[model samples]
Target: MNASRHLLPVLVLLLVTQWAAAQINDTLPAVVEPQVDNNRVKFTSQLRPLRGVAGAPAPFYTYFWEFGDGTYSFEKEPVHLYKDTGDYPVRLWATNNYDDGKKPPTRLKKIKVEKKTMLAANTPPAFFKGGGSLEMITNQMPRPGEDMVLLLGYRNKPGSHTATVSGSVMLLYNEKQFGQNSFDLAEARSYHQEKKIGLDSLLAYAPAEEWNMPLQGTLTGEADSRGGGLFTASGGGNLPIAGKPQLKAFLKEQMEGYRQHHIWRINEVKQGEEQFMFLSLNTLPEMIKDTNAVVTISGLFIPDDPSMDVERFALDLQIVASHDPNRIMLKNRRLNYRFTGKNRENIYKVQFQNTGKGPAKRVAITVTIPGMLNTGTVELVDMKPACTWCDSAYANQSCIDTILTKDSIQFIFKNIYLPGTQQEGISDPDSTMGYVRYKLRFTKKMKKMPFTSRASIVFDKNEPIYTNRSVGRFKKGLSPGIIIGYNTIPGKKPQDILPQNYVLGFTLSEYAAYKKYFQWEIYLEKSRSYESYDGRRIGGDTMINGVGYKVEYRDQYRQQKVLSLEAVPVHFRYNINSYMAAGAGALVGVDVERSVTPVVETWIQRPNGQGLALMKGAYEKQLESFANWRGAFFADFQLGIVRAGPAAGIRFLQYINPSHQRIFLYASWKL
Candidate 1:
């Protein structure tokens, strides 16, 4: 029986280990199944069945296929026709939505086209017609410990009608505001003869008057309808144009906001011609764990021509647990608790894609509005498949209409044509996607708690496809507090010779947490006491064999000073309201320094028998010690503002070994 008891736990652990290994093996990467005919190839994927997540939509797979010839598609089984006969490498990313398992792994395959059967007449159109002079887009959202590709598209549009230009492009990542790096640049691929350069070399190309203000305004002040700015509250901000502050000034400003950056020097770019650069960024394993959080990667485009104005662009991507095309996001998911209040504006974006095999004439999106937000303040900031607002004058043209309920908002795209990803003759994946962005303000006196919202997308009369929940959380800010207290031992009267104890300390805890939080504290305490004792006289006025009687006496006085380093290692607190709170925790302390001074006097009677007393000995001594350990348990109550600012409280502490207790009256201010 004893042997079996000892072996049972080990057997159970082994079983668990095997089960976990089996679970991991069940989620292998998808296999690429390709069929080829001359230059035309049809690709299919065989993916492991998804393990569905509880309470989530039905499990499904989303595909992102990259053809070797600088082209890609979002179709499940894309059929491509190669114009040139060469070896092409193809890759696929199979995203399992509503699945409990990790995303399926992918393998790159090299497809060789030896014979050409058809003409290359249906070439895709060129980019940079509408995506501004400098723009960026990512293949997919970032997943921790995974890799993602960012494509930077730039054009030579130096307004002076210059035929050719040479300039540099910079990619900035890993915002310094976050404590840990979110991404590391693994590789950068450039087809053009772009050379990597240092920061100083890039700054050397700046124009004169570097400190002048930009023609474009600040990115943090308002939401940009163009969706190309450092998004703070809303989804967009002004994409700045360095009209006056030259290229060097902009680079200096960007350096302060980002932790790491990479610059590339372009030798030449012809007018109206566009160039592309692809960066492979590996999401660091220690990236921030907020799955719904958003991280930004900014870019700058500078022309060597002194007259050309520099341009800036930014792209925001959410850190996702899984890649899902239909999703909603708050651009600024983590907010400062101090500034989040009424009149604070926030932007919410809903994105939907058509996955069916045909186009939809109408699409409707309904979103749940968190109670703390004021729905009356909703304003459309931007949208794709851009259309005008519905009016009486727009019955025939395509337009968007809004309907508001008490707790939800619905946006209907009417008389519109949105192509499906699997639709025939569709080559551009971007053409099948749509999004709606709107801004809202917080209600007055909202609670400082996290909020979430999701969207339900409908294509014509089909079932609603639910998106992921977008959460808005306040950054767990730090609150530093100062404590001053005076403590007295319990069961001690005014005249009972009590030690004088005074405490001065500091505390650290979550800043104004909604209800409950833990705190850690350390303090210095000084305790002083005085002690004295006297022995009664003995052998007084006694004589033996004609000798005087001898008497011995002793008296002593001592003063002690104890300086202790006190700490609270485990403290749990709960705030009942804005002004009242309670807490309980264990406190530990050690006397770092201690000192004691003693005065002793001894008296002896003379032998004359006449009782003549004289002092025989007198001495003063000092005693010292280090590291006297002690511990106590304390429960405290507070009055006044418990979250921030000033507060006063009293704590009761009971010592474990000595069976002594103390009461402390303290005042604190949390800042």
Candidate 2:
């Protein structure tokens, strides 16, 4: 057992050693090489080589190199151009296949290259005291297949009155003609000139033909003439006539062209006489396409007399590229088709020169959409501000204005000038300038419907009249009773019935027992009278009588019940709110019905044989019942909490019947 244990340990140790060896064999040895320096080759157009030596030569090799600029190379010798004249590190490596049993290799090195420097150009171009010039300066010539940009500054001399200067620049390519350009610049301030192009004269000049190039030349006229002698010439402000005939002819031709083409006036003569006119055929030189060229300008002053020598005038010139290759040139630029739809979906396109010196900034377009019947959408293809004003307006619309919608579309160009440069930034001073395009759609619905009736009725009854009649005297009257009335016709007569007139059948009523106490009774009433009036009053006497059975139930500190059969004159009673009431009716039955009265023996009496007299007396007393009927107008004052929905109110009724008036309290719920 002891031997086995020892042998086991020995065997394990051998196994571990073998495994380690296998791992080592699996990984190829790494070869570290020196780093190469890139600076040595930067200034020269040559390839730099880096080398690494392994322990011995091996087959199956590959190479890798890391340039400083995040780039890798696989060549043993790598050639690279330094974007700028500077120093940089270069690295390289060579690897052999693992089967070769040799470590991969790497190497690095530093090198230096020298660059040549060039002189600087800072001198400004030559120009007359009154003229200006512009030029560009750069550190070095552009490299092969590279682009360079330079800014040129220009300024005019103070106190210079020169106006209408023309100039051009010649661009030479490899010392060969590349392009020629020209530009016309107007003076910053007005100057006095005599016998010059006046507004009226210029207005008469016809516009040049569309195909005809614009005149590209300068104009020079004598400044104001100095006052001469003690008495200066009175008409000194006007130009003196010199070479009048030639000027006149030139003016006539210009005027004709202006009238034909409607060219606007450039200026008007204010003072001095015509000194000289430099004119050029606006067409480009034919040689421009063949060779590079320089531009030179000259002027001559014409004397009034042909005998006088023509005076020479100083002039300036500028050269510019007539054509630029970077420009995307297009001819007769125009919009082809446009379509606008709801939700501001709009598309539009135009043909234009893209590569040339377009307007200094992008063109701005606004699509104004008129509100349409169904669609409510507006779109601007590409919108940008081309000029200062255009920029302001565009900014205003984007930031300050609330009327613009988010879905609107806009199209814009970075640098371009449109045909109406002069007119731009003039009108709508607050608006932006530039080429603008717009497409808009508007939609919505609007409608309205509107409509407006009166009703009144007047009841001609004794309501108010009767109520007013019974003001007081309640105790002397019969107990307040419920009065009912019916209509009855006594007779039909032509004179008595102008219109439909009917008599009241009778007024039914009930009176309770206790005097000046709470009592309840029932009664019936009728009226016998008929009258009709047409413009005049017609009246006739009538009788109201009726037989009624009544039960009296009274309670006021005492209880009482009364049953009676009586022939009583039914009285018509008018009861208003509270204040007053009045009634009129006749007694009819023969026997005066009675009810048993409690307490001591009650006495019953018969008529006093004053037949009509008794009737009259009863009528008088019962008339007091009419007092109950007295068109009692009770002005009941109500006092209670007012609220929405149903509410109960207590009112004090102060009423006056025909015989008397009293104040009673009542409560009611308002629905």
Candidate 3:
């Protein structure tokens, strides 16, 4: 009877196991499908990128999306835009780990995009062209007797009739004026050139004539209307000349006078060695402000022609810049910085401005103050800088600090924005308000005598502007200088890089030799407070792994006020240029530290167990010995007054780590 009972229990257990196996098999299929937001075709009239949305459910599943255009996405909800116009098939594959982790059946979608075109059937053809002062592509300023290239833009209605076009260009300055016709002697010359005629002899024989300068002048012109039938078959092109001979031949004397002062010319681009057909253009003398150049063109059509003229307009521009004195201005408000000795409160402000008609972009302002190292003589502007004539007109207002070129301070501001006329009372005077201000002091003498300062403004889009100089004469004088700086250590303990956090130091230097000599004599450093070599906690409370307990590391050192002395055996330098210097020399030093107890410390919670901060117990250890007397192969480079490179030394109780030798990178100063 006992054996039968045991057999019955075993049979039941076997049956239960079989049923559980069957249930697992039924749920193992793991069939999942991927979906998306938009699967319908759409049309756009532009050749721009397109974006699609994926609406796939996930979390337990990994998604992979294949965009038809050779791009793929692994995101659960992928979004893509096609920059090209075409038909693309997108597919998605999703896999979940619940089963064998194999990709499920792919989800495919089809999308079609329409072709893109720049012109629509309903929109008329347009033209956009001109020169400086005019919004066009040429980045140039015209010079006296220079041939000014006038840009021509053209586009016509697709089904326009053929037509003939001409233009009349004129330079009008009050009573003084110059004008030209489409079919003039210049045009005849171009016509002769097409037949391979050499006009060198004719041109040389041309008499020299004086140019008339009007008190007030204006420039005017146009093009699309001057488009001949040639543009209708394709598109319009730029022409140098565009005028008709309308004034009667009886006015030949006046025309001759105008022709003598101003002439028409043609410019051509070349492919390989083949020169392109000459494009009609105009030549003008470098006229000053109040003078304007004018142009006018017309499009004429005949019945039954496939192309016709449909526009007419005029272009006029007033010349404002001059070849002699460009529009940039500079001045130093402090005038001449007079000093009695090697040191002085060399304080001043420099102002720069763009007085031209256009905004200056990518302006590089360089201020050269020879004989000054940024580290010593240059102090932080102290507080927020004062601006007498600026209100966010310029972006990137920060200075480049010590620019290495010629001991100069340089920085570049992008897009010096000019307010439009619509902007309130800011007229020409208000425009002069943008200038740079710097305040500094010089405590040490320079390698050369007589301090001379000058500034320059460079532009990426225009000619550079220069400032007049301020020269300072030396008097038998002297004054003190101050400098504060920082350097950081990388290690398991005290991982801080703040100037105050790493080092607090003071250095005094003197100009001992001729005007060509200077040396750093005294240096003092104070160690900053830091947690023990461990970071888990600071002060009385610290951290422990996997536990809610506290431990603390304390800051300690013996005779912490460490001092050092340096001598200048042979001081020399290699000049890379008028603006940069490189130098190296042997320096030996002895660390001064009084005998005292050196300790490592920690803290623990008190027996009262009140609060971590309320009660504490302190622990410390005294070291057996510490090494001293250290120095290394040191190299120094001066970019103007800015310095860089590595160094080595020793501190009391702790020999300066050779690895930490780079701290000198933050230790140089000129004053």
Candidate 4:
């Protein structure tokens, strides 16, 4: 038994080493193959064989194609139609999932279209479908120091007008809420005659036209609003505002919230025609390194013709450390500790992709839920590969079946055909990707600490793939407390001490911390003390004449007032339970104002006690400013809601200089 115990740790270490080694990816390359039929082209990619992960799903490659004409596609083989014949450089980025190797490097191919053979009839006109005018999308989630592409799609409403129009488009990123810039615009490729302009220029390019539109409406309706003559003039003309200040005000309002802005002026966009603009953004090294954190980029389209409505779109992406197909993210990764309780809701999203050569008939995603979150409060917020919830009516149809366990939730995609990344004739990589977002409320009683959850994805009958841990942490919220205390020296008589010390102060600490944390205290103290002694007779003082001298007596009275500023700069505290806590630290204080009042009187009496004389007020009061400095070490214990809110404590302080001790009783309330 002893030998087995000694070898157990060694065996566990070896297993961990082997598992880590299996996760290292190899460097593979993908080559792009394009077939050109004059202005039309059919694009394909030749990929190297993917190294399969042991006991894992079959390895495959997911492709992102940029056709260099401000147009792109996620399909395995996409057919693109060029408006004009030219030499365009096409780029391919392929990611290998379920493979024991690095992502394949990007490949670039230049295709020259010298002849015109295919007409506009070969192109699909539903690029911006379902009445959507502006759309923003990204090729991949951002990884620090990696490059990603963002495509902005804009189109005029199909039946709005038949004439050409000019517009300005703005791309806003690097939200000021984050500490550093997440992405840098490396390059922009616009096939159309789109000219980059400054914010001032974009705002200044106002055309002389306007259309009446009501401002009082829902936010969603305003975003998708088509121009209408809501308010008419005397001659049935639409009410018009000079220079469209409302639109400009809207644009300026958005600009203030972001740190980086890129604006482009697009010219001569015909109605019912879709336009594209591609931007290559490089994730900076200083980007937020939290893998579960999310960032957003917004795109705005404003046509010069005020008759057309404006459009705005936002694209949100998660920051990643690797090109992993299966991952989990927490939308509220950082929460305010003070405001977190049973009523707070946290949203988590789990995304998975089938990277096999064949389609997956059944996909199951098992997520481990943190204990702080209430499992009963799980509600599905959104999902991809959209389907109805599984029930008796949908028993044999495509649906998502959910099973709740004590500590986990399993979402099973049943009776569905989800395409694989390497499946033949599958062009869109998005077809292989699926995700589920669910919101969970916190438990009634929970600790102010970070929690993490992860997902295990299984495709068909293959091995499970584990994703990164999605972490949710509480922000170190501050707790400001009002402190009132009384100080006294023990083992002192009333006449010897006359202790009347009072202290008023405040404390600062982490709000509702479950574990050990530090706190700071500052205090202002005022103490008034009085001491007096009756006259005492001593041996007769020598008289000036060398004869019998009269008896001499003296009377003394003293009073002191001290105002001090005390600070406890270093104090460590730990909660023993919900109501009890212990702490110990040192403090230094200075008596900013000190005043002393001394009164002495002398009397002379005859030796026979026949005569007596009195002297009063011989010595007056003396005051000093900024006189004394003191330091002490202290330990304290608190009771009654020690973690937060109201608490009362008793402290013992040992003064270093003069070697004295004081007892302090205090009450505090954390706000």
Candidate 5:
């Protein structure tokens, strides 16, 4: 028995060696990323493919359209003009081919058209954002291998600069996640919808359904495991499989789905004299096999740095040395597989454990899918039957992403917290281990056959990656789970609530002075701007209606200066938009000069429109003798804080005369 067991590993090794030799890979096909016009509205329109995928062939593409304005265009990008202003719903369906009554991918959105007369105005300080220099510490160019850490350094630029840097790093189609975990991998490997899925399809997983939209993007870099994938356990690191032969056989089978790449948005940067951002890159394990692939990084500022005149910053790096992937080990925590519910209701459950020395931060498990043993397996719900249920006691739904393809789907589980860190690794029950359970559709059609499957795993701690694959046959069955990545139905979706948003600001307004009104007067101003979640933009009060205010100096004829205080009871501002606002309010004040102002005014324009002399002593005596008051009903027109307003009402004893209305029109600056 011992001899037979030992020989099995050797036998498995030989078979894998033979298989790798028989496999073939010559040339990789191109990718297609279609770009159609996505605007609210346009007078003239244009459509084309991005990069160099254009000019392929018209017959290969099929276009469908719904202009919403009772019109349609079958062209790539259709140009249409609307006779009136209204929201128009637009839809476009683009397909490389229309095969077997299949629906193509499409884009849908509403276009807005506006027709209104607008006046141009020069304004400033409505909104603000600033500048800083960003330095990245990564490969000027990088080669495919282990996941890498990127260091971002930022500093404010000279002279009146903003201290933050916000942007994104775009990696195009270069990112490929494992796809179709439940579909028959073994069948997919051998069967083709049309021309056979070449051996290249193994390393390069583009099922027949994806031929219309090939993976055509420039590949800059990828992640890969180094060294043999070690299985870390309480007893110390050991081979995950029973023997080396099994290990070899697993690696060979994994050769089919070897790929790596994970790049997403860069986070926002806070203002400071200097700041650093650390980024962890997720890549494919297959990339390590290639010793000569370079990786690149690209970054562009948010809202765009209109001043730079440059589009983005790019850096690339190359790989140097590699290590054994087996350094950190991850395996089925439990050593078995089982199934329940026959026909379209079979559930498969598998658990993996880490029996190695290192802790893996990211773990990707690719479950092999076998071709339908029974044609009775007709209806396919949510492509990856394995991912139908993403949450269970063993698996956390928050950390999974699944990508589905015609034949296979891959479940990407990330941020795995194992027992180990830079210093030590985890121990018993810490679960250097985890499990996955899923349900796939299958039924015994004619001949009963043993259920079978093959799977591969890729994991790492940013360096010296680890990977392994295993094949299992069902003398039994198993349980299930869901995804951490990919845009497929039955996949995990984002479940987060947005925070409340609103702007709070302060504004001060100083209107007009009194020398010109032949009396002593006061002047001041106010205004501010911001928006709220309710779609309302509230701002500081705007001086509209132009009943302007004026600057009045102490008149030469009157001497004594008055002491007084002002209280404003009502004030309100209206936001027309981001640029304009109108304001109205009522004001009242107590000024020693208020009571004397009408007397001075009466003395100056004596009902005859001629100057009338008044003594300074008489003004002072009367100012102190009676109760003083001032009030106004004002209207203002404002462009920014520069305001123009007109206010009219009574002053001093002038309130005693019902029709005594003196209007002041003025413009002034405010803080």
Candidate 6:
């Protein structure tokens, strides 16, 4: 019974242990609660409440803060100063320890700090009108990058106007800013007043840095009309002015609108003798009427002493027409004239008017005649009535003398003229007809004479010449002539190549009675030759008789060879006056038996050779047939006439083999 009781205790212990293990493995329910607002933390507050768990304790705690001046702070609840004027952020955190036995204890809530509010003073100063100048006072000159406070005082009639007035203060600077405590203004000042403001003090932060000082307030106040006051003071530095000559020149050249009426002059000289100048721009309409003027000071004048720098001072003036009242009239009246003549002596007359509103003075005229004159002489003449003040005369009889006046000026010219020419008779004909040209210019001041007008003229002559000629010959007639010639075949054995023999031919012309050194000819010729080559001697006579026509064009001559297909044993000949010619024709000749025997008997004994020998023999027999057709093509070069009367040439002849489909050289002409 005691053992049984012990066993029950052991069973109960096991059950308890198993239950504990089950409880350890089980998960706790998730907490459902509101979270803390981390952005709502207030300044001066100690602890912040976080959201996400209402009944649960804080799980974790953290802090954060933001100052309006581009800075941040992190703490449960942070306190910080905004070094400058701006907004700031505040944050916080909460810690909580959860007691669930199944999981680890964790801090769960996080909160945010709220943005802080700041107060700003935007009120302006009140203005007062009085006889005395209103003074603005400050504790010290404004530092380079710091704000300054200004005390503005205004005085007026008692109860004459409202005592309270409001305005804004503006800060002007030469540079920009970075953060609240950082800026680029090296020197700064303060200014304030009812009617005027001035630089109170000059504060320098760093020598290399720049500063932006502010003008304080939109100053407002009432002022008595009798005692109204105004004050002026210098800023950190003097205002910029045009001090350099290059800058002045650039301004004068580029600033067209202000150039005409503005004049810059040296008004005074300083202790070092440096000239001080000021610019005066005319604002009146009449001063700049119809004139666009620019004056640039190119140089300066110093007192002329060896020791002093001052000397003769002069400004270069470049005057340009800016506005033209008669622009349309001038554009419409613009004229260009062209004069053409056969000779340089031909007079060219041109008349031109201003056709504009401006007057032309000291006009000049010049004449240039081309040197290509057949006769090497020329003269110029002016055709105007004689005047006492302006008269010019030419000594040459061909030239005329006259005077120039305001109304009109006439120019006359005379000279012997020549032009480029060709060969006298054969190729060209000569003639003389050329051109003259002129131009005029006007000057206000001349080095030799004042208020004079001048003109410039250029004349060139071109004479025409014929480049070719045309002639006529008798149209129809006939003439005959004989030519005796010898022919030799080309290559080693010249004597064996051809029987050295003579050739006789006849020539005919279109005219019979009009025989002269120069003549046109159409002819027919008949010739014969005997030729041989190698050890085989073959002689056959050939006759060539054909009618041909020729035409002489320029330096070149062309002739066509005419042949009748029915004419057998004849070769056609075509000749150009040049050394070379090309021809195509046919030749008919009977093969003549020579003293050499047939060589086919040497190969007749073999079984297959007999058939080959018979075929060769047949070929030889067919080649001997007189009725076989033979075509010839040739290119020939005339070397010279042999022994004077008969012409000879080297000809390359391609004769078609009737039996074998091959080309062979049948003959060649040798002088």
Report the number of the highest-lDDT candidate: 1
Candidate 2: residue 50 lDDT (0-100): 19
lDDT by residue (307-346, candidate 1, tens digit) is 5556666677788887677788897788888777788888
Q: Which stretches of candidate 5 lie over 4 Å from their true place?
A: 1-344, 355-358, 373-398, 421-425, 443-447, 461-671
**What ranking of all candidate models by TM-score puts the best one first?**
1, 4, 3, 5, 6, 2
Better of 1 and 5 by TM-score: 1
lDDT of 3 at 209: 31
Using lDDT as the measure, name the better of candidate 4 and candidate 6.
4
Q: What is the alpha-carbon lDDT of model 4 when measured against the actual structure?
A: 0.74
Evaluated against the true structure, the overall lDDT of model 1 is 0.75
Candidates' lDDT values, in order?
0.75, 0.25, 0.34, 0.74, 0.33, 0.25
Error of 2 at 190 (Å): 3.2
Off by over 4 Å in 3: 1-343, 372-406, 419-428, 443-448, 476-671
Query: Model 6, residue 529: displacement in angstroms?
Result: 13
For the record, the alpha-carbon RMSD of candidate 5 to the native fold, in angstroms, is 35.5
User: Cα lDDT for residue 617, model 6?
Assistant: 26
TM per candidate? 0.80, 0.13, 0.20, 0.79, 0.17, 0.16
- Candidate 4 residue-wise lDDT, 1-671, digit = tens: 99999999999999998766555334435788899887879988877667787765556555677888766666667888887878899998776656666566676789998887647744432244235456666666777876777767777667777478787888989999789999999888888888999867876776656634323211221111010111111112234445657657667876777999988998877777788887888889899978768776777777777766565565557787665777887765888977777978887778787878899988899999888887888998667677788885445788898899868999998888988767788655656777787888888778888898999998899888899888899888899999997787888555654335667998999989897999999997766455656456553553536765554776676667677799999999999999999999999988787777777665767556678766566456687876677899999999999888898999999998768999888999998
- Please write out the lDDT profile of model 6 over residues 254-358, one tens digit for every residue: 333221121111222222111111111112222211111212221211111112211111111111121110110000011111111123132222211111122
534 in model 3: Cα distance from truth in Å? 99
Better lDDT candidate (2, 3) = 3
What range of 10 consecutive residues in model 3 has the weakest lDDT sum?
A: 226-235
Q: Per-residue CA lDDT of candidate 2, range 271-355, in tens?
A: 2211111111122333233111122222222222232222222221112122111111111111111121234322222212111
TM-score of 4: 0.79
Lowest summed lDDT over 10 consecutive residues: which window, candidate 6? 323-332
Estimate, for each residue in 1-671, the C-alpha lDDT of model 5 and write its tens digit: 99999999999999998656433110111222223233223222222322112221112333334455533333333445554566765655333221211123233466666752233321111111123244344211122322333444343334524455333222211312223111111111101111222232322221122111111122212111111011110111122243334423433442333332222232333354443343434343444332322233433221122222112233333322321112111112111222222453443333333434566555665655555423233222221112333444245433566655544556666555543312152212213445454555654431123344545555553322222222222221211111011111122243421111111212343222111111112332121122212122222222225532221212223333344443445656554533345556665655433222222221221234454433232233334632456566555444432222322121211222233443332332231
